[model samples]
Target: MESFLETFRNLDTSQKILYVFGGAAVTAVSLVAIRILTLKEEKRKDYPRDKVILHQIGRGPFAPSMTPFAVKLETYLRMARIPYQSQGASFNIFLWTIRRHNKKQTWNQGHGRHTEEEIVEMMNKDIQSLSDFVGRKRFLMGDEPSEADCSVFGMLSQTYWQFYGSGYENLIKDRYPNLASYCERMKDAFWPDWDQCITHGGTREATK
Candidate 1:
């Protein structure tokens, strides 16, 4: 264990990042495999033809979503003009527990490897990269929004809206005004009824 720790500590920052993410990838794939092998297949739901049902994490009274991938997939569906209904709290509890465990393990590994400042610097670098890439462009890839926009916007929404009072909000709102503007454009275009979607966003009906 001592030798292993020493070796890990000796690795460069990029290598450490790669190792952490690679482990996460493996963990995700293993979870999927286990689920396929052990879980009984449910009878498929009958949706109207051409309609899709998205089982995302339940919406909070706060942010659009607590999970980025859920937001990403939903945003992609919207951008593609596909019809879908959002359902939440429908996932297997066992899988959810496993995910939480994996999250802790990943967090521990990352923080153990780097200082808080180092982590923040890395994150800010990523934000800057995104800002540089999207400078003055109406969308990520220029005039029209695409699938890529959905993915980026989903992740950015966390820093912009969800992680309030955490200084990450400033990363978007202050440090990178272009990214902030891009998020606003995406929200304005894709999620016009965003206010109604949240639990306390009034009794107004949320857009499907």
Candidate 2:
């Protein structure tokens, strides 16, 4: 142990980075491998991916077959005894709201049948919904950080914190301070390496 520590400390900067990221990669692989090995043979065959399975389903007339990739990241995290807030059914609503929000439009720009004011109003309605839904909790589902927190933080952080701000940043900050603060708190908690983790290439500067 002493020799290993000495070697690690003596390593060059690049080697140290490789060591850190490599260790993370190794830990992730080990988790998946062990998890798969522990399951029953039939279950193993069914769930090739770690604790998640996808099947084709009929989505009525418009789109006959849809393959929804169900991610059980939270479930897998919990099975491993990892701390995570269950996102519940709120994540689905969040996804739908985001999908409907058009970031390309401005206060005067109109697209399709909806005018700019109508679009902004619609987007604000969703944002306000988020503001109410998030409320005062530190995490999406609760005070404790969970997988749901990780997911929500990823999306919200990009808009508010990512170096190149998103098209809808103002819509949130002007009215949804709670959501903005939530993003900051999550960054402080799980993503101390926020600035360095995902480098932005766009011209826009980072906010807060």
Candidate 3:
């Protein structure tokens, strides 16, 4: 009998798409079966009591999840004071498997056809522009804080505080001292207990 790969190679274009989809469906069902079979009631003890198990795309240690939906859902869970734990699938593996060999197509769809270096350059330029706009001012609009400062500071704080070891932290700290100062100024003014609020594990403590 011909091997599966040999049979697949002989398929026409429409047949190939169907074949791939069928294989993927089988694999997904198998994974789900395995998970269900392995996770006996006895295994429940390993998980937190009464906590929700959230399944979503995995994220790198320093970056937010690539899926805005996951981020929004997680944020809602946190804000609602719901107890939950995330079980993430490997994002790169997910993309690879789902996109098959179409990496260029995936990249174009996801990142607007920009190379990694190009994306970083664009981000740095935007930050530099903001740095120049802030210049010697205490805030983005002027010396006094404005609504714009609130929005800008929220985004900047994510880079300054959460994205550790990523060059973005250094980008703001080293190249844009004014922006760094601006973040600090906003933090001091609004989040007065900022340092104390940070836990030993580097996460900020939850507040009302």
Residue-level lDDT tens digits of model 2 in 1-208: 2222233335333233222212233223333443444445435444333333322111111111011111123223433555432111112322222223322211113332454455456556666787898898887788777676654553444345421222443545777999978867765665443343221332222221
lDDT of 3 at 94: 38
lDDT of 3 at 21: 17
Error of 3 at 206 (Å): 4.1
lDDT of 1 by residue, 61-84 (tens): 334664556667888988889999
Checking candidate 1 for backbone clashes, the offending pairs are none
Best by lDDT: 1
Top model by TM-score, which number? 1
| Candidate 1: clashing residue pairs, number | 0
Error of 1 at 148 (Å): 0.8
When 1 and 3 are scored with lDDT, the better candidate is: 1
Candidate 2: give the clashing pairs. Answer: 84-146, 85-146
> Candidate 1 vs candidate 2: which has greater lDDT?
1
